[model samples]
Target: MHVPDGFINAPVSVAAGAVAAGAVAVSLRGARRELGGTSHAEGGGERTAPLAGLVAAFIFAVQMLNFPVAAGTSGHLLGGALAAILVGPYTGVLCVSVVLLMQGILFADGGLTALGVNITVMGVVTVVVAYGLFRGLVKVLPRKRRSVTVASFAAALISVPAAACVFTAIYAIGGTTDVPVSKVLTAMVGVHVLIGIGEAVITMLTVGAVVAVRPDLVYGARGLTAPLKLRVGGELVDAEPAPVPVAARSPRAVWATGLVTALVLAGFVSFYASASPDGLEKVAADKGIDKNVEEHAAKDSPLADYGVKDISDARISGGLAGVIGVGVMVVAGTGIFWSLRRRGTTDATPTRVPESV
Candidate 1:
């Protein structure tokens, strides 16, 4: 969940900020290896960087849809399980972080002051816990696309409550208000457990869709299925490698399709999202978690609260904001990933000397 300003004390917020900064720095370096490593181990193909970027944008778009969970509470995609399963864990962290940064600075969804808190709880914690659980589950389950889907569902389901617990712990230590720690812990985890079901369903569906089309592109599926062993007279030997795909759809096509879907979801489908408060906000209001909550610095921005400033029609204003958010997120994410991909190339490329030397 996006933590707004003044939820936690200043000291804890600053500490969380430092932790978030370090986590992001580590993710940037780790993403190079995940994006640029040898084929089959990292991304599906050479377009890994762009694919990762598109995944980030897709996460941003889907997160706008706050589907109703229970009563007046609603939940949206966290994207940690989705990204970690589709791309890689390191890149997943970077993906959610990018969304948080954009939301804080431009749309005022998350607070700039609590940016680090959001990143730490939503990005780092979710990715780590979900990915860890995913890897472990895949290890024990049957090595198949279905197994990956199941693991994704389970991991994503757990991650939401895990993040809620983490936030509760942080609040216990650094809450600005006098809300009881036990109550906050119970409410946050309970409501988010319901939210986690929504997360699991979305994660399972998305991961299953990708696995069906391009299993190779799924990072979590990599290496799960081992090469076949064949009996060669007396001793067993490795079976013949599968032929390279010839008529398979181009990655650019897949990317374009995904981008279009994101635009459609954000621009139009988001209108149906629940008007009630999300899990975190509802818990906060009911529990008085943020008595010291501060106004968002970007409250006056053109796209604050996911609506255009001057548009009179609710549908039109929200639609425009969503479209703008998708466009900006895609551009920003693509640029960052492209630059990282280039850097990875530079690092991998060997230096050549002149004949004169």
Candidate 2:
């Protein structure tokens, strides 16, 4: 959920900002290793570096579609589980953080003042919880593609309520006004539990689709099974590794397809998404959660409220804004990931060992 301005006090917000900053810093370092230490210049960076950018753009686009969850309440993709399964946890954190940054600066979907809170709750917390549980589940379940899908579902289902609880705790600590904390907690977690179901379904479907098409590209599926071995009368025989077929589409082609899908979702499909207030917004209104809510600083921006300022047609305005958002997200995310991937390669390269006397 995108926390609006005044949702959290300045002191707590600042503290959360520091936490978010540290998390991003650590994730940046971690993403390098997760990208397989491949620089684009070396022609070895296709695995997760570019795909990480696509993941970020895809999450941003999917989040625009708010599926109805209850009476007048809708839910969108948190995407921590989806990203973590598709990419690695560190890269997943970066993906969601980048989306939050774009939404805050370009779209004004989230409050700039509460940027740290949003990143902390939505990016760090959700990614950590989902990825942790996912790894745990994968260890216990059968080492199959289906197991990865199941783990992704369970991880996503839990992450939503976990985030809601975290927000409630934050509000409890730094709330701007007096309200029944218990009531807020109940409402927040209850509705989000239902929202979690939606999150799980989306995460499972997306992860499964990718696993089915290209299991090698899935980070969570790596190392799940060992090489084939046969047992004959108390003797173990190693079988030859099966020759894998080349993918029908090159990595660049797959990246292009994913980018196109993200654009289509944001630029067109979002037009028909439910217009109802999302879960957090609905809860805030019903429970007086925004008693001290302040106007966003960027309220008058051209793309504020997910629409262009002077565009008369609602569809055109929203479509243009969505397209602009997707484009910006792709360029920005790709730049960040590629730079990190290159830096990682340089750092990981071993220095020449001089001859010792």
lDDT digits (tens) for residues 291-349 of candidate 2: 88998888888898889899899888887888888888888998999888888878889
TM-score of each: 0.94, 0.93
Clashes of each: 0, 0
Candidate 2: where are CA atoms >4 Å away? Answer: 38-45, 229-244, 247-249
Pairs in steric clash, model 2: none
Q: Best-fitting candidate, measured by TM-score?
A: 1
Computed on alpha carbons, the lDDT of every model, listed in order, comes to 0.87, 0.88
Which pairs clash in the backbone of model 1? none
Q: Which lDDT tens digits does candidate 1 get at residues 32-126?
A: 77776655444443667788888988998899999998898988888888888788888899999999999988899888988889999999999
